[model samples]
Target: MQTIANTTSDFIRVSSEIGTLRRLLIHSPDRGLGKVVPSKAQDWLFEDIVNLDMMRRDEYDFYVKLLLYFLDPDKIKGRVANLAPGTDRGFFKPDHPDYFASEKVIDIQCLLSDILADEVIRTKLIAAICGIERTSFKTQQQLTSVDPVELAKILISGSLPDRTMLFAPLPNFIFTRDIGIVINDHILLNKPAKQARTREALLAQYIFFNHSLFADYRDKIIEIPDNEHAFLLPDSDTARDLSRSTLEGGDVMMIGPRHLLIGCSERTTLYAAQQVMRLVFDKGVVDTVTIIKIPKKRDYMHIDTVFTQVKRNVWVLLGTLARTGDEARKQDVMHFFAPKDLSEDLKILQFRKGQEQKPIEIENLEDLLANISRNDLGATEPVTFIYSGNNEFPFGAREQWTDSCNLLALKDGVVVGYDRNDYTAEAFRQAGFDVVTAAEVLDRFERGESSPEAIENTFIMLPSAELSRARGGSHCMSLPLLREGF
Candidate 1:
């Protein structure tokens, strides 16, 4: 557990999604999760109340340990024999005295604390957060007196050390991928659509702008201007609000050095997508930008949830949205009688910097994925698709609900995903990828029987009973700050 004084500026590039991961951001589940009561769960964007203890100790603990092994091995390599994680609280908790504070396997809470150590930043942040929470002047004064580490915890969990509630909990902080994304070397911060996520974006903005770890690239940060009255409008029931420019990191992907993908889904609107596309093009960051528009349903909130890269030529996605018009409609006899459900259809349009009017419309999801691999990546192998739940009846929708398609690729063809999605795991196996449990892999690494370098084209399964309740997968949980370019 080492603290980061500064991460080299050159270590902040992410030109491809499936490149080897060297550094990233993640958050450990906090006590705020335990406070989500059924009455306020929907308002807070949580599907259901989760057992906080189980989610932390049994499920998320594995994710932390697994990441430590892959990115910062020395921190936990020899500690496996002595660390009784079940009984130890300090090892994983960022606020605890015995926490493993690795620089490479960075935690957002730690970065928050680091910046708060400065009196100027601490005062400014207190005012900003207090304004958003609408806290009383007395409460803001009291917060100014708290320690940086404690204050970071309180700001995120919305609880004091005495278990007193101060404001609404930022439960979605665990989904770090929604805050901001690094494209090439520039950082495009997120503008959240839902009021529930407003604080998350605010905190991220402060950290990226003020933190010395990212000081070298501060001038390159891009922000979208919201609608003049967007703040006053109550959460919209419809998905694409053109007047407002709302964007999340989950909708933005750095597919290749010369290409970027932005989704016009529930969280991101076409206005924001166009704004970002023009910004990147003017900056000469990338030459191609593709926007994939899907239904605004809560089930498919972002493009990453529908599909993510497994390898240069491999993709796992939901078949319902990837199929052609004829394939999407089942039973030709009944097709004539039933009106097509326009809501389930997917639309993809690609734009080049100088040729905006001649945008090319892609027919299906598979075609867009294959083009990225063959043309953008120059892959010699044939492109392949592994459908969610093996593209079977009932399973495709059922497993997608549990995040079978949302996976984080540790490296090309090596990924981390939930083990609960049995059908998706079988699909990975059929695609010639070996599926193994994270616990077993950890044991093997500890005993020196296997290593991260030796693993390839494999699915490292993680425990997901309680994590699934959050309705996000590893892809949503991670913010890759640095990755090797293919």
Candidate 2:
């Protein structure tokens, strides 16, 4: 472990050293269940309130086995119990003032205390926490009459009257990669916008700053003076409610130290993305931050929903939205956010003398399918796009909701995808990739199987009903610390 004293050093610029990936951080499932329930699971940021014990144990097995596979003990780490040292603190606790004030009061602190102090309360707490009610059927008028904070308090108390409340559940903790953005050897522990995810951020802050596995690099944290909320708003409304513009790490991706591809979706705002870019640019953290707007649809909610890079310039593009007829003529609406010519494409084609006029075009699904086969010629690498649906039917609208395009890149050519996507697997196999089944992975999770394993070169495909409902895939669930050539 190496520790440097320059606190202002930037850690976002380095091209990832793929083979030397010894230190990667993760968060196993924890007290996030109390925040999710059948009735309010949708609003709580979860698709369902699962069994906490099962989820945690499964997550433990996943992270543990992954670490074992890597064979680098110090390289793989989890921050579930690491957030609050010597204390079994959950994300939500009733004792915290926020619990009483907010309708989603999970009381992570008090709940953790009870979990540690009494086994009986822990069981009851888990039940109440995961037994929350849903408001999906409530009319707008009916919902408006109840204060959100008051409703949250009532729900927590009603569900689990015996346990103390602490904090709201941290649903985003599973995707640890997005919580902090790395710049060179430094990491900026972002002050997240959502209160629910604040504890997750705090836990991450603790891991990077205090834990022996990663604490040596504390001085590398980006510390802006007198700007606690510097990472939140762009010097605009400092007093505004933080939750209104809530952002998460899953919605952002670092293409390189200088260049980035961020998903501006329902969870992350366009202004928020711009504000983040401006903040980092001012510090010379990055040169370009490409704002890839996610189409406003449940299925196409994130950038990773449609496009994902496999090797260098080679990408597995899911051709879902095809523009034809009148919609195609209005250039702005059709091609505004379309993946016409990405920066990666520009840099890879060594066009000299400002000859950057090469435009990558794919008309319909057939055109895109044809270009991929022809584009990588002379290049030994196998390249192809696995069409999510059959070519016979024009599944323009249906593809988006079905996540026909979202595939997790394992190595340069290898990938892990949904088993339900038999067509996608066949396409990849045709493209010369060893497409693996997610059934074994899901079965391993259900069986409480545990062993050390490395997460490198391994794309774990989790159950994505809730996540897919938000329009993202395993690629959205993961943040890469290493790339092949980098």
Candidate 3:
């Protein structure tokens, strides 16, 4: 594995995916992006806001340009040289041995052990045991004596077609951020928060651990404390240990390589975030993590939904109400944004040096957008806002809930996002960004399209509603491995 010294540079560098990133990952919005249409959209907590056809067009252009604009030209071509602008169902095809096997078996443990052992033989071993199991080798000695690659072949040869090990496809993979976390030069393959996203974890692990571009550098993917996989705090009275023992990469953000601001949403509890912080600290991955408490609200799923970083000392805020109440319904949250001076009531919570303070306030999303142009917290910096709904009068609270504010940046000024809200595009233009659409690009993924490496960075992946039904967007679905200008 490649070994590199950790630097103390304040400007966070976004290298290759591993220790020296040569390429990155993303999900182009596809058919899956809108599987939750009609009756299910709202029930799926879609926030009653969307323009499906227009959204596709806008998102396609955004992702295409995002990668094209950020990645190195040579690197982009090398990674996506094989992809087209359409679907590739052949991705699901098994290896030749699996094809010959009569049956297959799902062996999660063996899969984990082989990859973790070391490189060289990891791929061969993974191919071998991907689908078949051995019942004859009952003794530990028999199993241990067999070479991973050989064992895999033997297992495949003995397997039956009906018993073939079925590998689950990554349906939510379009949201690439859920799979890993960028820590300086290294990136950690994170443990996912939901079973639905597990395939993404595996795919990311494969790309990072086995891919030639990243295999050399494995030491820096931040390790968990004491090699523990889970962290749960002991129960306490009154408070009920609101902190969780589990964490998802979706809730993590790097204000800087060493400085982080994380959200403790329902998927990510305070305890879990704290434990992750502890583990990160132990590994010296960051200097601090300001945990932002997110009150339970179906619409305000994650912190990124309400707030996202823009540039140096600046952010784009939704300017909605501070989350409140237990069992708070959408109607209740709507009440907060109903007033004419809704932005004034909306608070901007700042976290730096381990403490959080209210840095500024706005009367509405529009004011917040306008305010980003000036210095609010003692510093003259650029802060931008994208009103979730129409930027004009007659605020549309429902539109904000569809995650109008959630967006992922590929570089300093370029980004990838769903185009459900036109006002958001205008906001970007106002922020001086060159906006693009996802219409044709997304259709390519749905049609299994491939793009030449030169165009690889041009596309960004956005998750469909299959997983979005669970309340997340491409930004929420992805776990970034590299980030610049955080």
Every model's TM-score: 0.94, 0.54, 0.56
How well does model 3 score by local distance difference test? 0.43
- Off by more than 4 A, model 1: 1-3, 7-9, 82-91, 227-240, 324-344
Per-residue C-alpha lDDT of model 1 across residues 100-136, encoded as one tens digit per residue: 7788788899989988999999999999999989999
Candidates, ranked, TM-score: 1, 3, 2
For residue 148, give model 2's deviation from the true position in Å.
31
**Top-TM-score structure, candidate number:** 1
lDDT score, residue 75, model 3?
21
Tens digits of lDDT, candidate 2, 256-327? 435444556645665566556555666665555555544544455555555555543344554434322333
| Best lDDT among the predictions, by candidate number | 1
C-alpha RMSD (angstroms) for model 3: 10.3
Q: For all candidates, what are the clash counts?
A: 0, 51, 78
Candidate 1 structure, TM-score to reference: 0.94
Question: How many backbone collisions does model 1 have?
Answer: 0
Better of 1 and 3 by lDDT: 1
